[model samples]
Target: MLPSPLAAAAPPLPPQSSDEDFFSTASTSTSSDSKPRSPPPTLPQIPIVWPEAGALTASWVADLMQAFEWASKALPPSEFPSVLPVAVFDKLVLTASKILHKEPNCVRIDENSELNSDCRVVVVGDVHGQLHDVLFLLRDAGFPADDRFFVFNGDYVDRGAWGLEVFLLLLAWKVLMPHRVFLLRGNHESKYCTSVYGFEKEVLVKYGDNGKHVYRKCLGCFEGLPLASIIAGQVYTAHGGLFRGTIITPSKRSKKKNRKVVHNPKVDSLILGSFEELAKARRSVLDPPWEGQNLIPGDILWSDPSMTPGLSPNIERGIGLLYGPDCTEEFLKKFNLKLIIRSHEGPDARDKRPDLGGMNVGYTIDHIVESGKLITLFSAPDYPQFQATEERYKNKGAYIVLEPPNFDTPMFHSFEAVTPRPKVNPYYDFEDVIDSDEELDLVSMVTDSGLQQPAV
Candidate 1:
């Protein structure tokens, strides 16, 4: 059963225009044959009606307004600048209980009030630009002004076609309700995925030569995102799991030298270096030639899922970290955490391994690891291709709802199954198949329902 938080002090906001409908007109402007038309005009300030007590502070509101204004002025008219609707902005205020002023480095939730002993936390998984799925999951999990806290894993972009829409929607939510939502940076939230996938292409198509501006804005936003979050100091969550050797320590090396260290657990050490230093080190670790069987802790930020158990046999291989159930349990014990929620895997895979440690430990898996971590949840679901039904797709989509632990209750929830679609094989070679009868037969068997064949 879903855990409901104590009565929220704030009231709910009115419904707003759906993001899909708002962007429908802009998305359909892809007529290559037509004359090159100018971009859309700058977006006007969405007059949001926020509750008086819950309204964002003047400075915070101003900073966001300035960003919107700058984004309007800097962005060209031909490109559709108004991605977020005004109504969505207004709804953000209705969901918060209280806001606080604290060190900008850490996200402090409910600092004004004592920690709500019965706080309910909803953790979501990777969105991968599946806006519709996200909405569905939110509806299923109870969203839009719910009193529960939320945390989104990462991988907000790339792979899916609607990456821009996903980014804009979440950014708008962040602006309107900074406390309710938190974003974490996934490995894909960097320059590499943006350049190769539909993310960069979408920006170019929407903004023309100014696409880089959008990309840079996204990267800048990602830079400020936290790598991980501790929920109630019991549930440790991040886009990726902890590195095997990531222990907290003090280092006296120069800032440059210290920046090269793989996993400095002390949060203060990260502040010693510039964004450039972090980016350079991140790039170096992500790229090849490092000598190790398992991935360097830094490299784990971008590593894909490896469900296999034990350290890899090849010592010099860069196949990424592979954590079995035991490793997860060990990490949780070391950190004094009951569970770990991560988002690097797809929904289907998540469904299969919802309870990573079998026994209750706090390792909850929210899919979107790239977004920030705090009191927010993601609604995005698996993209169209990932929605396939074959055995592999059976466990593809679903998020989790965690009720505060009780004497007889567990700390986390199990994975739920999502509707699956037909699986597509990426490695299948259609061109070479026509020459082989066996290949043709196999293809026919997969695509056709009634093909009589002799038994072996």
Candidate 2:
């Protein structure tokens, strides 16, 4: 059976106290329809605050101040940059504002579904819409129609100019084999990133207003995606790392009993819904106030892969955040899992360094590390165009294959395989090269069978 939807819903709180109201009295005033009302008077623009010398060069400072001034005068108050405190450096504020504009604070993933017993799995790294590379990897890995299940591990769009095409192909494949194929939400799947990075605008450019239809379809796919999955009772796979306040417990009752859980109360209420419920809970904890201390185990869905081991000292006490290995052992002991397979980190990470020697593999962009207890994989072989370098491998592209456990052999088979390329050099004509009648006949026999004859 396909996974079910999460039961969490926005709560209907009692009427708010007067101070808590979001709608102001001014906003409620309705002008008479008989005559159109005049536009409201513009407020005085705030002067640009310049940074002190040594902090920012005069030219750089002037340019930013000019830009801010221009924006203040041209844009509406709601669109203006928030005023920074005098004590904060103007240059810092300007830099931060630019970063914020590029990378939105919040990301949204729509939803997705998958069959329950499709246990054997292989998750591809980020595709970034590299059509040839994606197809090559799938073909080489024996995917799409293989008995083994597959997860795209988020990042199906953006970076590559071909996000739409890539997503459409995946959508078609999903329809063909809904039970075996799954797409999970990635940080790049957000509206903020899509708006700036080209996926959203690309669709608009390609489909016009109908572009929104495409966007909605993609968002729906994202929203319905399972945040993470446990396969063959041993692995947990998602786009990113675990959130700060998350704790993994054996039972749903324990998750509820934990007082530190501060995500949407609705999510806590729906703990028993399905694996998708765990995903919704992850979204809430990883939202705004991300730096806030109350994260829970479900929050791991949104956490970024970190090189640092052990609990972050900056994190609050009493919250049960554990290393990937600790998490692996705990899950193994409690749920009878033999290992933990995760894909947030790259498959080629420097050393198999999970805090507790857990198997981990990092297989995509940046680095890929494959350890015994934890493994990181990436489906997008190329680095995102907007970001750093692409992943390096002897093979043209990559994917993983998992088999049932055996006492004589390890539980999983994970590695990169090199693909031979066609020879580019011209063949040589040598007088002594198999000129005998028997040898010539043998060459002719090989060529007749569609095999390449030895170069002469």
Model 1 C-alpha lDDT per residue in residues 1-456, reported as the tens digit of each score: 232121132223234343322221221111122122112223334333344675444343433333332243344423343433233332442232112112132233442322365555666656766544443344345442335566667677765545665565555455454555666556566554455445666666555555676566556565555555556656655565544343234466654455444442232222112222322233222222133211332334433333453432212122234454445555555545565566564433334454432111112332212222211122233222333434433232445555545211223322222222112222223233221111123223323433232110
TM-score (C-alpha, index-matched) for candidate 1: 0.53
Q: What local lDDT score does residue 259 receive in model 1, on the 0 to 100 scale? A: 43
Cα lDDT listed for each candidate:
0.41, 0.39
* TM-score, one value per model: 0.53, 0.48
What tens digits encode model 2's per-residue C-alpha lDDT throughout 322-405? 243443343345544443334433322222334322222324222222322444455544233223223332222345555444
Candidate 1 residue spans exceeding 4 A from truth: 1-79, 82-115, 144-146, 246-300, 303-319, 347-396, 405-456
For every candidate in turn, the CA RMSD to the true structure comes to: 15.3, 25.9
Top candidate by TM-score: 1
